[model samples]
Target: MIPEDILFEYNAKIKAFDKDEKIFSENEIARNYYQVLKGAVKMSNFNDDGKEFIQGIFYKEQSFGEPPLFINVPYPANAITLSDSEILILPKERLLDLLTKHHDIHLKITENLAKRLYYKAIIASEISGQEPMHRILRFFDYLKNDVHELTSNSSFKIPYTRQQIADVLGLRVETVIRSIKNLEKKGEVKIISRKVYR
Candidate 1:
């Protein structure tokens, strides 16, 4: 929640991770806060059968894996680099100390965590439904609302690939591709080449 400069001033270390690199595995003890400086990261967990269940995909300037650091528990999911990315690592104790001094930073962290909880509630219902198309559309709407300027019917581009969408939505990649095509035909969204806009 603190600015980049403040993090660098307080027990921060810069690390570069390659795509597909495991930043931390499931059940690992969370001792640090991570802020992505560039590229992307995905947090996920695998089922007993090895099927991946994506928690979320984070892009530049986004932070991940905070709950365990606060609660003194292990990480519930794995954090992996989705692209070659630089991360600023802040130790848990140092971060907690910093938070006590910065009221605005503490408030920002609370606000962001609340937003994530709200998103999770929305997706919980989306995935439990039988309609893959609606689930996909709802997720698209969520993404647009999250980081873009939205008007009544303004269009925005989706940042993730079809496979990424499927993993997050608990659908097959083929299902995502097919459902997107259908959405395009229905004039609900438009896809040009591989870029998806809704």
Candidate 2:
């Protein structure tokens, strides 16, 4: 992600949002570059049956909704604040200019996009063909290894709730709870005071 000072130098502005506030809607024109300054945001969409499918959850210092800027398309999902949050936003033109002048930052952005693409590909495959346990493990592994940079076999506390995990993995919350218990019984994960750790 771009440094705070650099973003500010390029005229980035920080805006506050209440919990569950929509930062932008699906199909909205991509006119700004957004980075979470505090709290979190989830990029998601609802199905015809009103079931929510979460595209991704971004925490502090992470950027979201950038693919549209690169592709010249509208946002594919809605971005909503998960809590009272502050977000730094830069105009699309200014962001482009900032990237043009900062090669390292541009490369970093490209790398981040590539990581997201890889995650999407893996998740797509898992959802289409894998069992529930396999999907859950793969999802946790990606978040631990790729996103959190945790070493294999180390205990990593899951940051998301069961409902959030179910939404992200296209499963029901009850299924997620059952799977977590199964995983615990198999020693794949530990349930410590109702929190899951892997």
Candidate 3:
């Protein structure tokens, strides 16, 4: 993520959004770079039956929807605020200019995008045929090591809800709940006061 001061220098504007507000829709043209300043945003797509499939969840300092900006294509998913949030927005042209003048920032952005691509690839494989427990553990491990950058085997709390996990892994809510409980019984995870820990 670009530093706030650097973003401001690049003509970025900070905008606020209410919870559940749509920042952009599927197929919308990507005209700006968006980075979270506070709260969370989720990128998702819904099927014809109204079942939502979560592409990803982004938190503070994380950027979303940049692949389309780089390729001059429409966004593949919708971005919605998970809570009342502030986001820094920079026009595509200005962002490109900034990147050109800042090679380090450009490299960081590329690295961030590469991590996201890797996560998507791993999740795609997990969802195809893996058991529910395997999928859940893999997802949690990704969050612990990659997203949160924690290395210890000590407890790591999960930030996502069961429904969100279900959406991301293409499983039923009941399945996620049951799988989590089974994991807890097997010592793969810990649940205390209804919050999952890994």
Candidate 4:
């Protein structure tokens, strides 16, 4: 993510979005690069059956929807604010100009894009063939590792609701709830105070 001072130097603008606001829809032409300055954003989509699939959830300092900027393609998923948030936006042309001048930022963008791609690949693999229990554990383990907070059999929290977790895993909320409880009973995880820990 670009630092605040760098954004200032670029004259990048910040905009506020209310909770549940749609920042952009699937297939929208990508015109700007965005980073969350506060709150959260989720990139998601609904299939023909109206089943929601969460591509990813992004928090402060995280950038989303930038692949479109680089590829000159429309967004593959919709971005919506998970809460009232401030977002930094740099126009595509300005971002390209800045990248041309700042090799470090360009590398950072590459790293960010790589991370997203890796995550999507992992999720796709998990969803396609894994059992519910394996899928649940692997998914939470992935989240924990991403935060660099993994510990041997120690507990950690996933910053998402059961429904959100289900959406991301392409499972029903009830299935997620049942999976978590089963995992807990099997000593693989614990659901304390209605929050998941593993």
Clashes within 3 Å, all models in order: 0, 0, 0, 0
Runs of candidate 2 with Cα error greater than 4 angstroms are: none
Alpha carbon lDDT of each predicted model: 0.88, 0.95, 0.95, 0.88
For residues 1-198, what per-residue lDDT tens digits would candidate 3 score against the true structure?
899999999789999999999999999999999999999999999999999999999999999999999999999999999999999999999999999999999999999888888999999999998999999999999999888889867689998999999999999999999999999999999999999999
Q: What is the TM-score of each candidate against the true structure?
A: 0.94, 0.97, 0.97, 0.92
Candidate 1 accuracy as lDDT: 0.88
* Candidate 1 structure quality by residue, lDDT tens digits, 8-82: 879799999999999998889999999998889999997888778898988878899997899999999999998
Worst 10 residues of 4 by lDDT: 146-155
Q: Clash pairs of candidate 4?
A: none
TM-score of 2: 0.97
lDDT per residue as tens, model 2, 1-198: 899999999999999999999999999999999999999999999999999999999999999999999789999999999999999999999999999999999999999999899999999999999999989999999999988889997899998899999999999999999999999999999999999998
- Top candidate when judged by lDDT against the true structure: 3
Task: State the lDDT at 161 in candidate 4.
Answer: 95
lDDT of 3 at 101: 98
> What root-mean-square deviation over C-alphas does model 1 reach?
1.5
Instruction: Evaluate residue 11 in candidate 1 and report its C-alpha lDDT on the 0 to 100 scale.
Output: 70
Better of 2 and 4 by TM-score: 2
Whichever of 1 and 4 has more TM-score, that candidate is 1
Worst 10 residues of 3 by lDDT: 146-155
